[model samples]
Target: MAELKEIVSTLDAELDIKSFGKDSSFSRFIPRVYEPLKFDWQTAFEKDFVELFNGLMLKGNSTVGKVFLAVFPTDKVLERFIEESNSGDLLFMHHPLLMECGDPKGKWGQGFVPIKEKYIKQMKEKNLSVYTCHIPLDCHKQLGTNIAMAKKLNAQILVDDTLNAKNEYVLYCNIEKTNTANLISVLENIFEIPYVDFEGKKLEDIQRIAIVAGCGDVVDWMKEAEENGVQAYITGEIHCHIDNDYGKQKYNQIMEYASNTSMSLIGVSHSASEYLVHKTLMKDLFEKNFNVETVLIPQEKWWL
Candidate 1:
Protein backbone atom coordinates (compact mmCIF):
# COMPACT_ATOMS: atom_id res chain seq x y z
CA MET A 1 0.00 0.00 0.00
CA ALA A 2 1.20 3.49 -0.83
CA GLU A 3 1.15 6.13 1.87
CA LEU A 4 -1.68 8.61 1.24
CA LYS A 5 0.53 11.53 2.22
CA GLU A 6 3.14 10.45 -0.35
CA ILE A 7 0.57 10.37 -3.12
CA VAL A 8 -0.83 13.73 -2.07
CA SER A 9 2.71 15.16 -2.03
CA THR A 10 3.39 13.87 -5.53
CA LEU A 11 0.16 15.46 -6.76
CA ASP A 12 0.95 18.71 -4.98
CA ALA A 13 4.36 18.80 -6.66
CA GLU A 14 2.86 18.10 -10.09
CA LEU A 15 0.14 20.72 -9.59
CA ASP A 16 2.61 23.28 -8.21
CA ILE A 17 0.41 24.11 -5.25
CA LYS A 18 3.02 26.50 -3.85
CA SER A 19 2.56 28.82 -6.80
CA PHE A 20 -1.19 29.14 -6.18
CA GLY A 21 -2.15 32.68 -5.25
CA LYS A 22 -4.11 32.71 -1.97
CA ASP A 23 -4.83 36.44 -1.74
CA SER A 24 -7.30 36.82 -4.59
CA SER A 25 -10.92 37.83 -3.91
CA PHE A 26 -12.19 34.70 -5.65
CA SER A 27 -10.06 32.62 -3.28
CA ARG A 28 -11.94 34.10 -0.35
CA PHE A 29 -15.26 32.97 -1.79
CA ILE A 30 -14.25 29.30 -1.83
CA PRO A 31 -15.88 26.97 0.74
CA ARG A 32 -12.97 27.03 3.14
CA VAL A 33 -10.60 29.96 3.07
CA TYR A 34 -7.67 29.66 5.46
CA GLU A 35 -4.78 31.78 6.63
CA PRO A 36 -1.38 30.26 5.88
CA LEU A 37 0.32 28.76 8.90
CA LYS A 38 3.68 30.30 9.76
CA PHE A 39 5.77 27.21 9.40
CA ASP A 40 8.48 25.57 7.31
CA TRP A 41 7.69 24.06 3.91
CA GLN A 42 7.27 20.52 5.27
CA THR A 43 4.95 21.56 8.08
CA ALA A 44 2.99 23.74 5.65
CA PHE A 45 2.67 20.84 3.24
CA GLU A 46 1.38 18.60 6.01
CA LYS A 47 -1.38 21.07 6.87
CA ASP A 48 -2.23 22.41 3.43
CA PHE A 49 -4.55 19.66 2.15
CA VAL A 50 -6.55 19.41 5.38
CA GLU A 51 -6.77 23.18 5.83
CA LEU A 52 -7.81 23.63 2.17
CA PHE A 53 -11.00 21.69 2.81
CA ASN A 54 -11.57 23.24 6.25
CA GLY A 55 -10.30 20.12 8.09
CA LEU A 56 -12.92 17.86 6.56
CA MET A 57 -11.32 14.44 6.66
CA LEU A 58 -14.36 12.23 6.49
CA LYS A 59 -12.44 9.11 7.49
CA GLY A 60 -9.25 7.00 7.25
CA ASN A 61 -5.65 8.22 7.17
CA SER A 62 -2.04 7.54 6.05
CA THR A 63 -1.96 4.39 3.86
CA VAL A 64 -4.22 4.07 0.83
CA GLY A 65 -4.44 1.08 -1.49
CA LYS A 66 -6.44 2.79 -4.27
CA VAL A 67 -7.57 6.21 -5.45
CA PHE A 68 -10.94 7.03 -7.01
CA LEU A 69 -11.50 10.30 -8.87
CA ALA A 70 -14.81 12.07 -9.37
CA VAL A 71 -16.05 15.55 -10.30
CA PHE A 72 -18.13 15.96 -7.18
CA PRO A 73 -19.00 14.28 -3.89
CA THR A 74 -22.36 12.56 -4.10
CA ASP A 75 -23.93 9.71 -2.10
CA LYS A 76 -24.01 7.46 -5.16
CA VAL A 77 -20.36 8.11 -5.98
CA LEU A 78 -19.28 7.56 -2.39
CA GLU A 79 -21.27 4.33 -2.19
CA ARG A 80 -19.60 3.11 -5.37
CA PHE A 81 -16.18 3.95 -3.96
CA ILE A 82 -16.93 1.98 -0.80
CA GLU A 83 -18.02 -1.05 -2.85
CA GLU A 84 -15.06 -1.00 -5.23
CA SER A 85 -12.33 -0.20 -2.79
CA ASN A 86 -10.69 -2.14 -0.02
CA SER A 87 -10.16 -0.51 3.36
CA GLY A 88 -8.01 2.63 3.29
CA ASP A 89 -8.92 3.95 -0.15
CA LEU A 90 -9.00 7.62 -1.15
CA LEU A 91 -11.76 9.45 -2.99
CA PHE A 92 -10.42 12.59 -4.63
CA MET A 93 -12.91 15.01 -6.12
CA HIS A 94 -13.10 18.52 -7.59
CA HIS A 95 -15.93 19.66 -5.33
CA PRO A 96 -16.26 19.35 -1.56
CA LEU A 97 -18.95 17.41 0.32
CA LEU A 98 -20.75 20.57 1.41
CA MET A 99 -21.14 22.51 -1.84
CA GLU A 100 -22.53 25.51 -0.02
CA CYS A 101 -22.71 26.58 3.58
CA GLY A 102 -26.23 26.67 5.01
CA ASP A 103 -28.18 29.68 3.83
CA PRO A 104 -31.96 29.95 4.18
CA LYS A 105 -32.06 32.00 0.98
CA GLY A 106 -30.08 29.36 -0.99
CA LYS A 107 -31.97 26.83 -3.10
CA TRP A 108 -30.29 23.61 -1.89
CA GLY A 109 -30.02 23.66 1.90
CA GLN A 110 -33.03 25.96 2.49
CA GLY A 111 -31.56 26.45 5.95
CA PHE A 112 -28.91 23.88 6.89
CA VAL A 113 -28.54 20.34 5.63
CA PRO A 114 -25.50 18.89 7.24
CA ILE A 115 -23.37 16.30 5.44
CA LYS A 116 -25.43 13.12 5.66
CA GLU A 117 -24.42 11.48 8.91
CA LYS A 118 -25.00 8.01 7.48
CA TYR A 119 -22.56 8.58 4.63
CA ILE A 120 -19.96 9.87 7.07
CA LYS A 121 -20.51 6.83 9.25
CA GLN A 122 -20.30 4.50 6.25
CA MET A 123 -17.07 6.09 5.04
CA LYS A 124 -15.54 5.86 8.48
CA GLU A 125 -16.49 2.19 8.70
CA LYS A 126 -15.08 1.56 5.23
CA ASN A 127 -11.87 3.48 5.92
CA LEU A 128 -12.40 5.92 3.06
CA SER A 129 -10.65 9.27 2.86
CA VAL A 130 -11.96 12.19 0.83
CA TYR A 131 -9.95 15.05 -0.70
CA THR A 132 -10.99 17.91 -2.94
CA CYS A 133 -9.22 20.21 -5.39
CA HIS A 134 -11.37 22.98 -6.80
CA ILE A 135 -9.87 26.10 -8.37
CA PRO A 136 -6.40 24.53 -8.34
CA LEU A 137 -7.46 21.75 -10.70
CA ASP A 138 -9.30 24.21 -12.94
CA CYS A 139 -6.15 26.35 -13.23
CA HIS A 140 -3.71 23.51 -13.93
CA LYS A 141 -2.09 24.18 -17.33
CA GLN A 142 -2.33 20.70 -18.88
CA LEU A 143 -5.07 18.94 -16.94
CA GLY A 144 -7.38 21.87 -16.28
CA THR A 145 -11.05 21.60 -17.26
CA ASN A 146 -10.96 24.36 -19.90
CA ILE A 147 -7.61 23.19 -21.34
CA ALA A 148 -8.85 19.63 -21.64
CA MET A 149 -12.05 20.76 -23.35
CA ALA A 150 -10.10 22.95 -25.78
CA LYS A 151 -7.75 20.06 -26.59
CA LYS A 152 -10.67 17.65 -27.09
CA LEU A 153 -12.30 20.10 -29.55
CA ASN A 154 -9.00 20.34 -31.51
CA ALA A 155 -9.06 24.13 -31.30
CA GLN A 156 -6.04 26.31 -31.88
CA ILE A 157 -5.41 28.38 -28.78
CA LEU A 158 -5.51 32.13 -29.31
CA VAL A 159 -5.53 33.38 -25.73
CA ASP A 160 -4.97 31.60 -22.40
CA ASP A 161 -5.66 33.48 -19.21
CA THR A 162 -7.28 33.13 -15.77
CA LEU A 163 -10.88 33.62 -16.86
CA ASN A 164 -12.93 36.55 -15.54
CA ALA A 165 -11.14 36.88 -12.20
CA LYS A 166 -12.30 33.42 -11.15
CA ASN A 167 -8.80 31.92 -11.13
CA GLU A 168 -9.94 29.33 -13.65
CA TYR A 169 -8.55 29.11 -17.17
CA VAL A 170 -10.70 30.40 -20.04
CA LEU A 171 -9.38 29.69 -23.51
CA TYR A 172 -10.10 31.33 -26.89
CA CYS A 173 -9.35 29.25 -29.94
CA ASN A 174 -10.00 28.92 -33.66
CA ILE A 175 -11.59 25.71 -34.82
CA GLU A 176 -11.23 24.44 -38.40
CA LYS A 177 -14.24 25.34 -40.53
CA THR A 178 -17.27 23.73 -38.91
CA ASN A 179 -20.91 24.77 -38.45
CA THR A 180 -22.57 25.20 -35.06
CA ALA A 181 -24.72 22.06 -35.40
CA ASN A 182 -21.69 19.97 -36.26
CA LEU A 183 -19.77 21.58 -33.43
CA ILE A 184 -22.55 20.68 -30.99
CA SER A 185 -22.56 17.10 -32.29
CA VAL A 186 -18.79 16.93 -31.80
CA LEU A 187 -19.13 18.21 -28.23
CA GLU A 188 -21.94 15.78 -27.44
CA ASN A 189 -19.77 12.90 -28.62
CA ILE A 190 -16.72 14.18 -26.73
CA PHE A 191 -18.54 14.77 -23.44
CA GLU A 192 -20.93 11.80 -23.79
CA ILE A 193 -23.98 13.98 -23.26
CA PRO A 194 -27.46 13.42 -24.71
CA TYR A 195 -28.02 17.04 -25.81
CA VAL A 196 -26.67 20.59 -25.59
CA ASP A 197 -28.42 23.91 -24.89
CA PHE A 198 -27.62 26.69 -27.34
CA GLU A 199 -28.69 30.22 -28.29
CA GLY A 200 -27.82 32.91 -30.88
CA LYS A 201 -26.46 32.83 -34.47
CA LYS A 202 -26.67 30.31 -37.33
CA LEU A 203 -24.80 27.00 -37.65
CA GLU A 204 -22.69 28.31 -40.53
CA ASP A 205 -21.52 31.40 -38.66
CA ILE A 206 -19.25 29.91 -35.97
CA GLN A 207 -15.46 29.67 -36.30
CA ARG A 208 -13.55 31.40 -33.55
CA ILE A 209 -14.63 30.05 -30.13
CA ALA A 210 -14.08 30.58 -26.43
CA ILE A 211 -14.26 27.69 -23.90
CA VAL A 212 -14.63 27.78 -20.13
CA ALA A 213 -15.66 24.44 -18.68
CA GLY A 214 -17.95 23.93 -15.63
CA CYS A 215 -20.32 26.78 -14.65
CA GLY A 216 -18.62 29.38 -16.85
CA ASP A 217 -21.75 31.31 -17.77
CA VAL A 218 -20.52 34.54 -16.20
CA VAL A 219 -21.31 37.71 -18.18
CA ASP A 220 -17.73 38.98 -17.88
CA TRP A 221 -16.37 35.85 -19.55
CA MET A 222 -18.90 36.12 -22.37
CA LYS A 223 -18.06 39.81 -22.75
CA GLU A 224 -14.38 38.90 -22.90
CA ALA A 225 -15.07 36.45 -25.71
CA GLU A 226 -17.04 39.08 -27.64
CA GLU A 227 -14.28 41.64 -27.08
CA ASN A 228 -11.73 39.17 -28.42
CA GLY A 229 -13.81 38.60 -31.61
CA VAL A 230 -14.96 35.12 -30.67
CA GLN A 231 -18.02 34.09 -32.67
CA ALA A 232 -18.93 31.26 -30.28
CA TYR A 233 -18.80 30.70 -26.55
CA ILE A 234 -18.77 27.05 -25.37
CA THR A 235 -19.33 26.33 -21.69
CA GLY A 236 -20.84 23.91 -19.21
CA GLU A 237 -24.20 25.09 -17.88
CA ILE A 238 -25.98 28.45 -18.17
CA HIS A 239 -28.48 29.87 -15.67
CA CYS A 240 -31.63 28.82 -17.50
CA HIS A 241 -33.69 27.01 -14.89
CA ILE A 242 -37.18 26.49 -16.31
CA ASP A 243 -39.07 27.19 -13.09
CA ASN A 244 -37.06 30.24 -12.05
CA ASP A 245 -38.39 33.19 -14.03
CA TYR A 246 -35.53 35.45 -12.95
CA GLY A 247 -33.02 32.85 -14.10
CA LYS A 248 -34.81 32.59 -17.46
CA GLN A 249 -34.80 36.38 -17.81
CA LYS A 250 -31.07 36.53 -17.04
CA TYR A 251 -30.45 33.84 -19.64
CA ASN A 252 -32.53 35.74 -22.16
CA GLN A 253 -30.48 38.84 -21.53
CA ILE A 254 -27.33 36.88 -22.26
CA MET A 255 -28.91 35.51 -25.41
CA GLU A 256 -29.87 39.04 -26.43
CA TYR A 257 -26.29 40.20 -25.91
CA ALA A 258 -25.06 37.28 -27.99
CA SER A 259 -27.58 38.07 -30.74
CA ASN A 260 -26.51 41.70 -30.83
CA THR A 261 -22.84 40.67 -31.02
CA SER A 262 -23.43 37.89 -33.59
CA MET A 263 -22.14 35.29 -31.12
CA SER A 264 -23.35 31.77 -30.35
CA LEU A 265 -23.52 30.16 -26.90
CA ILE A 266 -23.33 26.39 -26.51
CA GLY A 267 -23.63 24.72 -23.12
CA VAL A 268 -22.86 21.11 -22.27
CA SER A 269 -23.63 19.42 -18.93
CA HIS A 270 -21.27 20.64 -16.21
CA SER A 271 -20.27 17.18 -14.91
CA ALA A 272 -19.63 15.69 -18.35
CA SER A 273 -17.33 18.50 -19.51
CA GLU A 274 -15.27 18.55 -16.30
CA TYR A 275 -15.11 14.75 -16.17
CA LEU A 276 -12.70 14.87 -19.12
CA VAL A 277 -9.96 16.08 -16.79
CA HIS A 278 -10.31 13.12 -14.40
CA LYS A 279 -11.01 10.39 -16.99
CA THR A 280 -8.40 11.41 -19.56
CA LEU A 281 -5.78 13.80 -18.17
CA MET A 282 -5.60 12.83 -14.49
CA LYS A 283 -5.87 9.09 -15.21
CA ASP A 284 -2.68 9.41 -17.22
CA LEU A 285 -1.02 11.39 -14.44
CA PHE A 286 -1.77 8.72 -11.81
CA GLU A 287 -0.79 5.82 -14.08
CA LYS A 288 2.51 7.47 -14.94
CA ASN A 289 3.59 8.31 -11.41
CA PHE A 290 1.87 6.09 -8.84
CA ASN A 291 1.60 2.34 -8.20
CA VAL A 292 -1.86 2.49 -6.67
CA GLU A 293 -4.85 1.63 -8.85
CA THR A 294 -6.81 4.74 -9.92
CA VAL A 295 -10.36 4.71 -11.26
CA LEU A 296 -12.65 7.43 -12.62
CA ILE A 297 -16.09 7.33 -11.02
CA PRO A 298 -18.12 9.64 -13.26
CA GLN A 299 -20.74 11.81 -11.61
CA GLU A 300 -24.35 11.03 -12.51
CA LYS A 301 -25.96 13.25 -15.17
CA TRP A 302 -28.27 15.87 -13.69
CA TRP A 303 -30.33 16.17 -16.93
CA LEU A 304 -32.11 13.44 -18.80
Candidate 2:
Protein backbone atom coordinates (compact mmCIF):
# COMPACT_ATOMS: atom_id res chain seq x y z
CA MET A 1 0.00 0.00 0.00
CA ALA A 2 1.10 3.55 -0.70
CA GLU A 3 0.58 6.62 1.42
CA LEU A 4 -2.43 8.73 0.40
CA LYS A 5 -0.23 11.81 0.20
CA GLU A 6 2.15 9.97 -2.13
CA ILE A 7 -0.72 9.00 -4.43
CA VAL A 8 -2.29 12.44 -4.32
CA SER A 9 1.03 14.21 -4.79
CA THR A 10 1.99 11.91 -7.63
CA LEU A 11 -1.25 12.89 -9.41
CA ASP A 12 -0.72 16.56 -8.62
CA ALA A 13 2.83 16.42 -10.02
CA GLU A 14 1.93 14.28 -13.03
CA LEU A 15 -1.07 16.40 -14.03
CA ASP A 16 0.54 19.71 -12.96
CA ILE A 17 -2.84 20.66 -11.46
CA LYS A 18 -1.69 24.05 -10.23
CA SER A 19 -0.48 25.16 -13.65
CA PHE A 20 -3.81 24.50 -15.34
CA GLY A 21 -5.65 27.36 -13.50
CA LYS A 22 -8.88 25.49 -14.13
CA ASP A 23 -12.21 25.97 -12.33
CA SER A 24 -15.30 23.89 -11.68
CA SER A 25 -18.99 24.69 -11.08
CA PHE A 26 -19.42 21.52 -9.04
CA SER A 27 -19.87 23.31 -5.75
CA ARG A 28 -20.92 26.66 -7.14
CA PHE A 29 -24.62 26.56 -6.33
CA ILE A 30 -24.54 24.91 -2.91
CA PRO A 31 -21.64 26.56 -1.10
CA ARG A 32 -23.80 27.63 1.82
CA VAL A 33 -25.31 24.14 2.16
CA TYR A 34 -21.99 22.35 2.69
CA GLU A 35 -20.32 25.29 4.41
CA PRO A 36 -21.96 24.62 7.79
CA LEU A 37 -20.37 21.21 8.28
CA LYS A 38 -16.89 22.55 7.35
CA PHE A 39 -15.73 19.16 6.22
CA ASP A 40 -12.03 18.83 5.42
CA TRP A 41 -12.87 17.41 2.00
CA GLN A 42 -14.68 20.66 1.31
CA THR A 43 -11.75 22.71 2.58
CA ALA A 44 -8.71 20.60 1.52
CA PHE A 45 -9.19 21.42 -2.18
CA GLU A 46 -6.44 23.50 -3.76
CA LYS A 47 -6.76 27.18 -2.88
CA ASP A 48 -6.40 28.17 -6.52
CA PHE A 49 -9.65 26.33 -7.21
CA VAL A 50 -11.35 28.75 -4.74
CA GLU A 51 -10.64 26.26 -1.89
CA LEU A 52 -13.12 23.57 -2.95
CA PHE A 53 -12.52 22.80 -6.60
CA ASN A 54 -9.83 20.25 -7.45
CA GLY A 55 -7.19 17.74 -6.29
CA LEU A 56 -7.53 15.85 -3.01
CA MET A 57 -10.89 16.97 -1.67
CA LEU A 58 -10.62 14.60 1.28
CA LYS A 59 -7.87 12.99 3.42
CA GLY A 60 -9.46 9.91 4.88
CA ASN A 61 -6.47 7.73 5.77
CA SER A 62 -2.69 7.87 5.77
CA THR A 63 -2.15 5.00 3.33
CA VAL A 64 -4.14 3.88 0.32
CA GLY A 65 -4.62 0.13 -0.08
CA LYS A 66 -6.69 0.36 -3.24
CA VAL A 67 -7.78 3.10 -5.67
CA PHE A 68 -11.25 3.32 -7.16
CA LEU A 69 -11.41 5.02 -10.57
CA ALA A 70 -14.49 6.60 -12.11
CA VAL A 71 -15.67 9.54 -14.20
CA PHE A 72 -17.75 11.03 -11.37
CA PRO A 73 -18.91 10.28 -7.82
CA THR A 74 -22.55 9.64 -8.57
CA ASP A 75 -24.85 8.24 -5.87
CA LYS A 76 -24.82 4.67 -7.14
CA VAL A 77 -21.08 4.78 -7.78
CA LEU A 78 -20.32 6.04 -4.28
CA GLU A 79 -22.66 3.49 -2.72
CA ARG A 80 -20.94 0.68 -4.60
CA PHE A 81 -17.47 2.00 -3.77
CA ILE A 82 -18.32 2.26 -0.08
CA GLU A 83 -19.77 -1.26 -0.07
CA GLU A 84 -16.91 -2.95 -1.97
CA SER A 85 -13.86 -0.91 -0.97
CA ASN A 86 -11.99 -1.09 2.34
CA SER A 87 -10.87 1.60 4.77
CA GLY A 88 -8.01 3.79 3.43
CA ASP A 89 -9.06 3.13 -0.16
CA LEU A 90 -8.86 6.18 -2.46
CA LEU A 91 -11.46 7.26 -4.99
CA PHE A 92 -9.91 9.13 -7.92
CA MET A 93 -12.45 10.54 -10.29
CA HIS A 94 -12.68 13.13 -13.05
CA HIS A 95 -15.38 15.20 -11.36
CA PRO A 96 -16.03 15.76 -7.66
CA LEU A 97 -19.81 15.80 -8.10
CA LEU A 98 -21.93 14.04 -10.66
CA MET A 99 -22.38 16.03 -13.87
CA GLU A 100 -25.82 14.77 -14.86
CA CYS A 101 -25.50 15.96 -18.46
CA GLY A 102 -28.57 13.91 -19.39
CA ASP A 103 -29.61 11.15 -21.77
CA PRO A 104 -31.11 12.42 -25.00
CA LYS A 105 -33.26 9.29 -25.25
CA GLY A 106 -34.30 9.03 -21.57
CA LYS A 107 -35.41 11.45 -18.83
CA TRP A 108 -33.27 14.59 -19.09
CA GLY A 109 -31.32 15.70 -16.01
CA GLN A 110 -30.24 18.80 -14.15
CA GLY A 111 -26.54 19.69 -14.06
CA PHE A 112 -24.00 19.02 -11.26
CA VAL A 113 -25.41 17.32 -8.16
CA PRO A 114 -23.43 16.88 -4.94
CA ILE A 115 -22.88 13.49 -3.33
CA LYS A 116 -25.59 12.66 -0.80
CA GLU A 117 -24.67 13.97 2.67
CA LYS A 118 -25.24 10.50 4.16
CA TYR A 119 -22.75 8.98 1.75
CA ILE A 120 -20.21 11.67 2.55
CA LYS A 121 -20.60 10.97 6.26
CA GLN A 122 -20.35 7.26 5.65
CA MET A 123 -17.14 7.64 3.63
CA LYS A 124 -15.61 9.80 6.34
CA GLU A 125 -16.43 7.18 8.94
CA LYS A 126 -14.92 4.50 6.68
CA ASN A 127 -11.72 6.56 6.27
CA LEU A 128 -12.14 6.64 2.48
CA SER A 129 -10.49 9.41 0.50
CA VAL A 130 -11.61 11.36 -2.56
CA TYR A 131 -9.45 13.09 -5.20
CA THR A 132 -10.78 14.62 -8.37
CA CYS A 133 -8.84 15.75 -11.44
CA HIS A 134 -10.88 17.30 -14.24
CA ILE A 135 -9.00 19.39 -16.83
CA PRO A 136 -5.73 17.85 -15.78
CA LEU A 137 -7.01 14.46 -16.89
CA ASP A 138 -8.42 16.06 -20.03
CA CYS A 139 -5.09 17.79 -20.71
CA HIS A 140 -2.75 14.85 -20.16
CA LYS A 141 -0.94 13.36 -23.17
CA GLN A 142 -1.26 9.56 -22.94
CA LEU A 143 -3.78 9.56 -20.09
CA GLY A 144 -6.17 12.27 -21.25
CA THR A 145 -9.79 11.81 -22.32
CA ASN A 146 -9.27 13.11 -25.85
CA ILE A 147 -6.03 11.20 -26.33
CA ALA A 148 -7.60 7.93 -25.19
CA MET A 149 -10.41 8.39 -27.72
CA ALA A 150 -7.86 9.07 -30.48
CA LYS A 151 -5.83 6.05 -29.42
CA LYS A 152 -8.95 3.84 -29.38
CA LEU A 153 -9.70 4.86 -32.96
CA ASN A 154 -6.12 3.86 -33.89
CA ALA A 155 -5.59 7.45 -35.03
CA GLN A 156 -2.34 9.39 -34.83
CA ILE A 157 -2.29 12.49 -32.64
CA LEU A 158 -1.07 15.26 -34.93
CA VAL A 159 -1.18 18.03 -32.31
CA ASP A 160 -1.21 17.14 -28.60
CA ASP A 161 -1.19 19.00 -25.25
CA THR A 162 2.47 20.03 -25.44
CA LEU A 163 1.92 21.68 -28.84
CA ASN A 164 -1.16 23.67 -27.74
CA ALA A 165 -1.33 24.15 -23.99
CA LYS A 166 -3.80 26.96 -24.63
CA ASN A 167 -6.19 24.39 -26.08
CA GLU A 168 -4.82 21.40 -24.25
CA TYR A 169 -8.24 19.79 -23.85
CA VAL A 170 -8.60 19.67 -27.62
CA LEU A 171 -6.77 17.19 -29.87
CA TYR A 172 -6.05 17.08 -33.58
CA CYS A 173 -5.84 13.56 -34.94
CA ASN A 174 -5.19 11.91 -38.31
CA ILE A 175 -7.13 8.79 -39.16
CA GLU A 176 -7.62 6.52 -42.17
CA LYS A 177 -9.97 8.47 -44.46
CA THR A 178 -13.55 7.37 -43.89
CA ASN A 179 -17.05 8.73 -44.45
CA THR A 180 -19.05 10.26 -41.58
CA ALA A 181 -21.54 7.38 -41.46
CA ASN A 182 -18.79 4.80 -41.09
CA LEU A 183 -16.97 6.99 -38.57
CA ILE A 184 -20.12 7.21 -36.41
CA SER A 185 -20.43 3.44 -36.56
CA VAL A 186 -16.84 3.12 -35.40
CA LEU A 187 -17.46 5.54 -32.50
CA GLU A 188 -20.58 3.65 -31.45
CA ASN A 189 -18.59 0.42 -31.27
CA ILE A 190 -15.62 1.98 -29.45
CA PHE A 191 -17.78 3.65 -26.77
CA GLU A 192 -20.05 0.60 -26.58
CA ILE A 193 -23.12 2.77 -27.17
CA PRO A 194 -26.23 1.88 -29.11
CA TYR A 195 -26.28 5.05 -31.26
CA VAL A 196 -24.28 8.22 -31.71
CA ASP A 197 -25.89 11.70 -31.62
CA PHE A 198 -24.42 13.50 -34.62
CA GLU A 199 -24.87 16.30 -37.10
CA GLY A 200 -23.12 17.95 -40.10
CA LYS A 201 -21.12 16.56 -43.03
CA LYS A 202 -20.93 12.94 -44.15
CA LEU A 203 -17.66 13.48 -45.98
CA GLU A 204 -15.69 10.51 -47.37
CA ASP A 205 -12.21 11.98 -46.86
CA ILE A 206 -12.37 12.55 -43.12
CA GLN A 207 -8.71 11.87 -42.46
CA ARG A 208 -8.43 14.58 -39.79
CA ILE A 209 -10.68 15.46 -36.83
CA ALA A 210 -10.66 17.40 -33.60
CA ILE A 211 -11.53 15.77 -30.26
CA VAL A 212 -12.77 17.48 -27.08
CA ALA A 213 -13.95 14.61 -24.90
CA GLY A 214 -16.48 15.88 -22.34
CA CYS A 215 -18.31 18.92 -23.65
CA GLY A 216 -17.56 20.12 -27.19
CA ASP A 217 -20.58 22.42 -27.17
CA VAL A 218 -18.54 25.60 -26.93
CA VAL A 219 -18.76 27.84 -30.01
CA ASP A 220 -15.29 29.34 -29.59
CA TRP A 221 -13.72 25.83 -29.51
CA MET A 222 -15.82 24.75 -32.47
CA LYS A 223 -14.62 27.81 -34.41
CA GLU A 224 -11.04 26.97 -33.52
CA ALA A 225 -11.53 23.39 -34.72
CA GLU A 226 -13.08 24.68 -37.94
CA GLU A 227 -10.06 26.90 -38.49
CA ASN A 228 -7.81 23.83 -38.12
CA GLY A 229 -9.38 22.32 -41.32
CA VAL A 230 -10.53 19.10 -39.70
CA GLN A 231 -13.44 17.36 -41.40
CA ALA A 232 -15.07 16.16 -38.14
CA TYR A 233 -15.29 16.96 -34.43
CA ILE A 234 -15.79 14.19 -31.85
CA THR A 235 -16.76 14.70 -28.21
CA GLY A 236 -18.93 13.43 -25.39
CA GLU A 237 -21.69 16.00 -25.60
CA ILE A 238 -22.25 17.90 -28.84
CA HIS A 239 -25.29 19.77 -27.42
CA CYS A 240 -25.56 19.29 -23.67
CA HIS A 241 -28.96 17.93 -22.77
CA ILE A 242 -28.73 19.15 -19.19
CA ASP A 243 -32.04 20.63 -18.13
CA ASN A 244 -30.88 24.05 -17.09
CA ASP A 245 -30.58 27.65 -18.31
CA TYR A 246 -26.92 27.47 -19.36
CA GLY A 247 -27.55 24.03 -20.83
CA LYS A 248 -30.36 25.33 -23.04
CA GLN A 249 -28.28 28.29 -24.18
CA LYS A 250 -25.21 26.18 -24.97
CA TYR A 251 -27.24 23.56 -26.84
CA ASN A 252 -28.86 26.26 -28.98
CA GLN A 253 -25.59 28.02 -29.73
CA ILE A 254 -23.74 24.79 -30.58
CA MET A 255 -26.58 23.47 -32.70
CA GLU A 256 -26.62 26.68 -34.72
CA TYR A 257 -22.86 26.48 -35.35
CA ALA A 258 -22.96 22.79 -36.29
CA SER A 259 -25.80 23.39 -38.76
CA ASN A 260 -23.65 25.88 -40.70
CA THR A 261 -20.27 24.19 -40.42
CA SER A 262 -19.02 21.66 -42.97
CA MET A 263 -17.45 19.47 -40.27
CA SER A 264 -19.14 16.47 -38.78
CA LEU A 265 -20.22 16.71 -35.10
CA ILE A 266 -20.25 13.46 -33.10
CA GLY A 267 -21.58 13.14 -29.52
CA VAL A 268 -20.67 9.84 -27.94
CA SER A 269 -22.14 10.81 -24.48
CA HIS A 270 -20.03 12.68 -21.89
CA SER A 271 -19.24 9.93 -19.37
CA ALA A 272 -18.46 7.45 -22.13
CA SER A 273 -16.08 9.94 -23.69
CA GLU A 274 -14.05 10.16 -20.46
CA TYR A 275 -14.31 6.47 -19.47
CA LEU A 276 -11.51 5.32 -21.79
CA VAL A 277 -8.74 7.10 -19.90
CA HIS A 278 -9.60 5.10 -16.77
CA LYS A 279 -9.33 1.81 -18.67
CA THR A 280 -6.23 2.80 -20.66
CA LEU A 281 -4.16 5.34 -18.71
CA MET A 282 -5.46 5.51 -15.12
CA LYS A 283 -5.63 1.74 -14.70
CA ASP A 284 -1.92 1.61 -15.60
CA LEU A 285 -1.02 4.53 -13.32
CA PHE A 286 -2.29 2.76 -10.19
CA GLU A 287 -2.03 -0.98 -10.93
CA LYS A 288 1.33 -0.96 -12.74
CA ASN A 289 3.19 1.99 -11.24
CA PHE A 290 1.75 2.68 -7.80
CA ASN A 291 1.46 -1.05 -7.01
CA VAL A 292 -2.10 -0.66 -5.74
CA GLU A 293 -5.21 -2.64 -6.50
CA THR A 294 -7.82 -0.78 -8.59
CA VAL A 295 -11.58 -1.05 -9.01
CA LEU A 296 -13.29 0.87 -11.81
CA ILE A 297 -16.92 1.94 -11.40
CA PRO A 298 -18.41 2.64 -14.80
CA GLN A 299 -21.41 4.97 -14.99
CA GLU A 300 -24.58 2.87 -14.83
CA LYS A 301 -26.28 4.98 -17.50
CA TRP A 302 -23.66 7.31 -18.91
CA TRP A 303 -26.24 9.26 -20.89
CA LEU A 304 -28.14 10.54 -17.87
Measured by TM-score, the strongest candidate is 2
Model 2: residue 206 alpha-carbon error in angstroms: 1.2
lDDT of 1 by residue, 1-304 (tens): 7887777777767666556645232334332322232223223222554445322244476788788988755677777887898888888776654232111122422211234556666777876787666677788878788888888888887644543333345777888988888888898899887778776776686778888887666777787777777777888765443334555566677766666656778878666767788888887877777778898898665331
- The whole-model C-alpha lDDT of candidate 2 against the native structure comes to 0.81
Largest lDDT belongs to which candidate? 2
Per-model TM-score on C-alpha atoms: 0.79, 0.90
Mark the 10 consecutive residues where model 2 has the least summed lDDT: 40-49
TM-score result, candidate 2: 0.90
**Least lDDT summed over 10 consecutive residues: which range in candidate 1?**
103-112
In candidate 1, which residue pairs get closer than 3 Å at backbone N, Cα or C atoms, i.e. clash?
none
Tell me which residue pairs clash in candidate 2. none
